[model samples]
Target: MVLNKIEQLLEKYENAETTLQEEQELKTYFSQDQIAPHLEVYRPLFAYYKASKHETFTKDIPLKTKNTNVYKWLTVAAVGVLMLGFYFNTSKHITTTDDDLGTIQDPELAYNEVVNTLELISKTLNKGTATVGYLQTYNQGIATVNYIHELEHTSNIIFKNNK
Candidate 1:
């Protein structure tokens, strides 16, 4: 009767359905001497569990963290560089006079300048429109492909109906 119950518990244990109490019963059964011949294979497994249960870590673990001294020195060096750059930047004299600012006093020269600027803007717009002309050709090619697909679909329907 005990052997039958042990077999049933072993089946459940193999399927991972055994409870903690059922597992303990199996462990105790396997730990005994003079078990059935076929059941002798599981003895070493239970013995291993029993031996491992008494094992412990003997060495001390170190909890030391990494040093950030290099990172701190890098941050200090970066701040020093920024301070030196600011010192040099502020020392330079940058005077912005009217002529340097490109302010025109003569009306005829100003009108001519406006016409030249408009001409440059128009040329840039014409270049953009030339690229758009390629897009228009691409759209026509896509429309042609779509028409070919419609013809193929109609031919397939007509041939399928004739068959």
Candidate 2:
């Protein structure tokens, strides 16, 4: 009689049609070592469910408060002190200087360097204009491809309408 009821319950459980009360009865029966020999395979599954049902994380987690503003203020104060020290140390060097800053000592050398820089800039501009001319060719090719795709699209539409 016991095995017959267990078989019926097992069928209902497999079909997910068993009620909570019937499920609890099945759990109670399977958790014991006195279960029938053939039903012993189901005991570990029920034991695992019973064991995991009571498990939970019980420790308290620490919460963050609004005391982070103190660290922000300290960081701002440290940066301000560093900037003030840098300004005072640099001001001494500026006040001690007697000659004009970065003035060219040799005028002919400065003029030669400027002329060489202008020549380099002119060469780079020529290279850029050559590349831009190639882009014109690329644009023409793209236009030709777009015309082909337009013809293909029209033919596809005509074929679809004929069907």
Candidate 3:
């Protein structure tokens, strides 16, 4: 009768309808030495299942150390310092005077001087304008000119109102 129950449980196990308790019972029955000769073929399968229940196939994976590129960061800092130094030097040179403050006294001359001074400032501040392609070069120059014109118009409006 126990052999018949074992055979039924094995059938349930094969059909994947056996509960965990039923599976454990099947394993228990097959693990004994008194199993029927006909069911002896299933002993190894049950042993594998029983062994797998307590056998852990999991492993603790060691984490890899992340490497940082400190030299790249150093290079970026060096470039930033160089850019700041260049900016300060160029700004000083562009604004420096030769003790002739009244030389640009005429408004028209002042306006042209302003435009030339702005162009020099833009050249110093915006070094990327030199490398722009022919297609974008006109647009970039136009944008700068428009910005300067807007500033000049605003200043003229303020000066006329004050006068």
Residue pairs of candidate 3 with colliding backbone atoms: none
Ranking by TM-score: 1, 2, 3
Summing lDDT over every window of 10 consecutive residues in candidate 1, give the lowest-scoring window. Answer: 92-101
Ranking by lDDT: 2, 1, 3
TM-score, candidate 3, is: 0.36
User: Candidate 3 residues 1-163, lDDT tens each?
Assistant: 9988988888888899999999889888888989899999999998998788797758887698555578779999999999999999999878978685567667898899989999999988777755555758789899999999999999999999999
lDDT of 1 by residue, 4-36 (tens): 998898889889999999999989998888688
User: lDDT for each of the candidates?
Assistant: 0.89, 0.90, 0.87
Looking at candidate 2, what is the lDDT of residue 137? 87
Best by TM-score: 1
Q: Which TM-score value belongs to model 1?
A: 0.42
Worst 10 residues of 2 by lDDT: 96-105
Roughly what TM-score does model 2 have, to 2 decimal places? 0.36
Q: Write the per-residue lDDT of candidate 2 for residues 8-116, one digit (tens) a residue.
A: 9988988999999999989988976688888888888889989998999999887867678889999999999999999999998888767757567799988988899
